[model samples]
Target: MPVRILDSRDHVLRRKTIPMVKILWKNQDVESATWELESVMRKAYPHLLLPIERLIPFSGFCW
Candidate 1:
């Protein structure tokens, strides 16, 4: 999967309020991708204060 993301301000549909974040990518299995992301987040920010719902991943570029 080719995953990508952008700040809400950089998105073409940034005007939308519901999604303050924009994750763009080519994903075959969304469920697996979601779990992978969650795992990574949990490891990276073990003491994160923000709720899981508020966390957003933004990847402007990928190799």
Candidate 2:
């Protein structure tokens, strides 16, 4: 899967209220990806809120 992340400041629809972390995943097989991400997030940032951006495909880069 290809993943891309953009900072809140770089997001197109920037919101001033909450800081955001964007996550994109490609070729993601449902269960494993979700669980893996959740596990990582739970351990890494236990308190901060994070929203995941689903299924973003690579447009201009090589794998």
Candidate 3:
């Protein structure tokens, strides 16, 4: 599971753009953080994103 979100960015595919977040995993270092699709992460781990959404008012997340 992820410990926290370190950063975020947009991943542009051939005809679409997807929001991605750099996730810091439990028992891992900064260098080990991996970028994952925000939508998928939200579906898989809604609880993890709740605190971050509450902290950042304008994080650009719909929910």
Candidate 4:
């Protein structure tokens, strides 16, 4: 499960673009965070995306 969302960006493909987010997982270090598809996270872990502003307070991070 995700502990919080750290950042977000768009992935460009040959014919399309996919929204992605950097996810901080439970019991993991900040350096271990991974990028996941925004759509998938929204479906599986909606709560994590709901309070995005509150979750990412660090400078240089955007959601």
Candidate 5:
């Protein structure tokens, strides 16, 4: 199962969690990289993972 970066129990404050992994490119652009990452995740581990933004919706979501 793909790990959910957002809701995982961690050392940091709950509000500070950001599940999306940021990838940096040689061109210093990330717009496409983000999408690529999301795509690979969907194909490889669709059942175990979900986009963090889809769950949180707004800026603040509490558990």
Candidate 6:
């Protein structure tokens, strides 16, 4: 079955987590980099991985 980013576990993790990824602390521009990467990924596999801003309940994530 195809797994959606809105999976329950992903939802909880994203909501509770702040930095999201531990390595984010290592880079000041990690946030911007993340957006860049996500943008490329979404374009490449738009159906497989949706945008993070689209939460599960309200709007969701994948790792």
Scored against the true structure, residue 10 in model 5 reaches a CA lDDT of: 23
Clashing pairs in 5: none
Cα lDDT of model 1 by residue, 20-55, tens digit: 333333654444332224334335544432554568
TM-score of 1: 0.20
lDDT of 5: 0.44
Where's the lowest-lDDT run of ten residues in candidate 1? Answer: 4-13
- What's the TM-score of every candidate structure? 0.20, 0.22, 0.74, 0.75, 0.27, 0.24
Two-way lDDT contest, 3 vs 4, winner: 4
Global CA lDDT computed for model 3:
0.89
User: Which residue ranges in model 4 land beyond 4 Å of their true spot?
Assistant: 51-63
Measured with C-alpha atoms, the lDDT of residue 1 in candidate 3 is 87
What's the best-to-worst order under lDDT?
4, 3, 5, 2, 1, 6
lDDT of 3 by residue, 1-63 (tens): 899889989999999999999999999999999999999999999877776548777756596
Which stretches of model 2 miss by more than 4 angstroms?
7-16, 26-63
Each prediction's total of clashing residue pairs, residues at least 3 apart in sequence or on different chains, is 0, 0, 0, 0, 0, 4
Our tally of clashes for model 3 stands at 0
Q: How far out, in Å, is residue 8 in model 1?
A: 2.2
Which scores better on lDDT, 1 or 6?
Answer: 1
lDDT of 5 by residue, 1-63 (tens): 333423222234557633343333345433433322444555766754555677667866668
Q: After superposition, how far is residue 19 of candidate 6 from its true place, in Å?
A: 12
State residue 16's C-alpha deviation in candidate 1, in Å. Answer: 14
> What residue runs in model 3 are displaced by over 4 Å at the alpha carbon?
51-53, 56-63
- TM-score sort, best first: 4, 3, 5, 6, 2, 1
Backbone steric clashes in candidate 4, count: 0
lDDT of 2 at 29: 41
